[model samples]
Target: MVRGKTQMRRIENATSRQVTFSKRRNGLLKKAFELSVLCDAELALIIFSSRGKLYEFSSSSMQATVGRYLRHTRSDQSHHLDQPLPHQHDLQAVQNEAASLLKEIESVEVSKRKLLGESLGTSSYEELQQLEQQLERSLSHIRARKHEVYREQIEQLKEKYDVEEERQQSPTQIQLAEVSPNYGESSSISDVETDLFIGPPKSRSK
Candidate 1:
C-alpha cells in the first residue's frame, strides 16, 4: 500500500514524522530548484523548520533580491507622494460648470417646445421678446403682400371701368349715319330710342 494513500493526521510515531518531514522538504526544494532552472525568472523561497533551522534559495544573490524588492516598494510610495490631489475649489468649479450646462440645455428644450406651440402659459421677458419679434416680421411680410395684391386688383378694376365708360359714350351705326345725314332720313326713331335706352352690354354688366 502507498503511504500517500493511507489518510492519517500528522504521524503519531516520532520516527515516521521525522522521515516524512525530511522527504517532503527534499521534494519541495527539488521542485523549487527545477522551476528556477527551467524558467529564466527571478525566484526566492524561505523556509524555517519547527526546530528553528533556516533554509532559503534565490535564483540570484538573496541580498540583491531583497534590495530590489525594497527599492520597488520605495518607488511606489514616492510616486504616490508626488501625485497632485484635487482641491476643493477645483471640484466646486467643475460642479458649477456641469450645472450651468444642464441649465442651458433645459432652457433650449423649453424654448423649442414653446415655439412648437405645445405650451400655453406665461413666459420670461426674453422669450416673449423673441416671440414678438417673430410676429412682427411675419406681419410685415403679410401686409406687404396684401398691399401688392390690393393694388393689382385696383388697377384691373380701374381699367375695366374706363373700358365700360368709353363703350357707353360711343354711338351706334344708325346714330352715326343720322348725325352725318340729317335729312328726313332712313334712320328709324325706334332705333334712336334703343341706342339711348340700351347703352351698351359691357356698361350694364359693370
Candidate 2:
C-alpha cells in the first residue's frame, strides 16, 4: 500500500517544530548539493530558522547567482513591456459597456427618487399621475389586509367567548341535574291530609 503524504505545515509544538526544522533543513541542503553535482545546474538555496540563523547552498558563488537572477527577472519585465498591448477596439468596447451600465444605474436612481417624491423637477405631469396611481394601489392592498386582520381577530374573540360561556354554564346544568325528584311539591301545612278521630272504634262480636 502507498503511504499517505505527510502534511506540509508549520508545527505548533515548540519541541516538535524545532525537530522538524532540523531534519528538513538537512534534507534540503543535501538535495541542493546532489542536484548541483549530478545535473551540473547553477542554483542557489537560502533558509532562515526561527532563531534568525542563516543557511545557504549555491552551485557557484552566491553573489554571482543572485545577480544573474536579478538580471533575468528584469529582462522578463522588459520583454513583457516590448510585447504589444491588447487591441484598442477591445479596450474601447469595455469602456463603452462600463459607461452604459453607469448611465442605466443613474436612470434607475432617478426613477426611484422620483417615486419617493424627491427629484421631481424633471418629472412630467404624466409621471406624477402614474406615481399617484401606484401609491393608491399600494394603499388599497394595505387597507384590504387590515380588514382581513380585523376579521380574524373578531373570529378568535368569538371562539374564546363561546368557550368561556360554556365553561360557566356547565356547573348550572349540573346543579339542575342534582335537584330532588319531588322538587316542585308544595311545602305548606295545609297541603297535608288531616283526620279528627284519635283512636279506631270496633263493633261488638255476635
Candidate 3:
C-alpha cells in the first residue's frame, strides 16, 4: 500500500533533509528540462543547497532567463542573494508591503462598518457636533432662500393689487364727474315749471 500523508514539520536530521533536497532538486530540474524540450517552451529553474550553494538551469541563456524572471516578479536584481535564503532587504520590503496592505484592508473594513451603521455609537462627541453643525448650516441656507423667494412673491402681489385699485377708482371718479352737470340742469328745470304753474306770479303785482 502507498504511504499516507506525513505530518507537516521541518525534518530535524540534517543528512536526511539534505538527501531529500538533492533528490527533489534533481527531479524538479529534470521535469523543467523535459517540459521545455517537449513543448518548445522557454524555461528556467533555480535551486539552492542548505549550506549556501547556488544551482540553476535554463533552456536559454541564464542571464536572459534570469532577467525574464526578474521582470515577471518585479524584483530588483541587485537584491538577489547567491545563498539559499532570501536577502534581508527583500524580506523587509515584503514585510513592509504586507503591513501597508493590511492597513488598507483595515481602513476599508472600518468604512464598511460605518456605512452599515454599526459604528455610530463609537463616534466622538466632537464628530457628532460637527455633523450637526453642518446640517444646521444647510437648513439655514435653504430657509433663507425660501424666505427671499416668498418676499419677492408678496411684493409682486402687492404691486398688482395697487394697480387694480387705481383702475377701479379711476372709472368711479369719471362716472361721478359726468353725472354732476346733468343733475344741476335737472334741478333748474323743476324750479321753472313750478313758477309757470303759479300763473306767472299775478302779472308782477301792478
Candidate 4:
C-alpha cells in the first residue's frame, strides 16, 4: 500500500515533539555529511534545542568556513563601493531636473508678466531696459504690418479707380470716333451755318 503523506504541523505532545526533533536533527546532519563527502564540497550546519543545547556539523573547520563566508559577503559589498546606489542617484537626478524645470517655468512666467505690463516693482534697470527693447521691437513689427496693409488697400483702391474711369470714358470715345468721319462734310457745314443767326435789322436802323 502507498504510504500516507506525513502532516507537517507541530506534534501536540511534548514528548513526541522532542522525539521528532531529535530524529529530524540527526537525519539532517547525516545528509549534510553525505552530501559534502560525495561532492567534495565545503559545508556547515548548526541547530539549537529548546533546552539551549547546541548541535553542529561542518565539512571543514567551523571557524574557517565562517571566516570564508564573511569574506565572501564583504567582497560582494566592496565590489559596489566605487559607485553610488542606483536608487539614490536616480532620485537625486530627478530632483535636480525638476528644480531646473521649475526655474525655467518661473523665468517664463516673469517674462510673460513683464510683457503684459504687470509686476514691474522689483525689476532692475537692466531688466526694464530689456523689456523696453522687446516692446519696441514688437511695436516696430506691428507698424510694419500696418504699413503693408495700408499699401495693399491703396493699391486696391487705385485699381478700382482705373477700372471705373475706363468704364466711363469708353462710351464717349466711341461716340467721338463715330462723329469724326462727318466733321468736314458739306451737310455738316450747312447745318452749322443754318444754326448760326445774324444780328436783327432793327440794329441797322438805329
On TM-score, the leading prediction is 2
Pick the winner on TM-score between candidates 3 and 4. Answer: 4
lDDT per residue for candidate 4 within 50-138, as digits (tens), equals 89999999999999999999999999889988988999999999999999999999999988998999999999999999999999999
* Tens-digit lDDT string for candidate 1 (143-170): 9999999999999999999999877774
Each model's lDDT comes to 0.81, 0.88, 0.81, 0.92
Per-model TM-score versus the true fold: 0.32, 0.52, 0.35, 0.38
Q: Give the poorly placed runs of model 3, Cα more than 4 Å off.
A: 71-206
lDDT of 2 by residue, 1-206 (tens): 99888778767899999998899899999999999999999999999999999999999999999999999999988987866566966888899999999999999998788778898887789989998998899899999999999999999999999999888887777777777544765355358757545444542221
Judged by lDDT against the true structure, how good is candidate 3? 0.81
Error of 1 at 15 (Å): 2.3
Candidate 3 clash pair list: none
What RMSD, rounded to one decimal, does every model reach? Answer: 25.4, 9.3, 21.9, 20.8
lDDT comparing candidate 1 with the true structure: 0.81
Please give the range of 10 consecutive residues that has the lowest summed lDDT in model 1.
188-197
Ten-residue stretch with the least lDDT total in model 3: 192-201
Separate clash counts for every candidate: 0, 0, 0, 0
How many angstroms is residue 26 displaced in model 4 relative to the true structure, after the best TM-score fit?
1.0
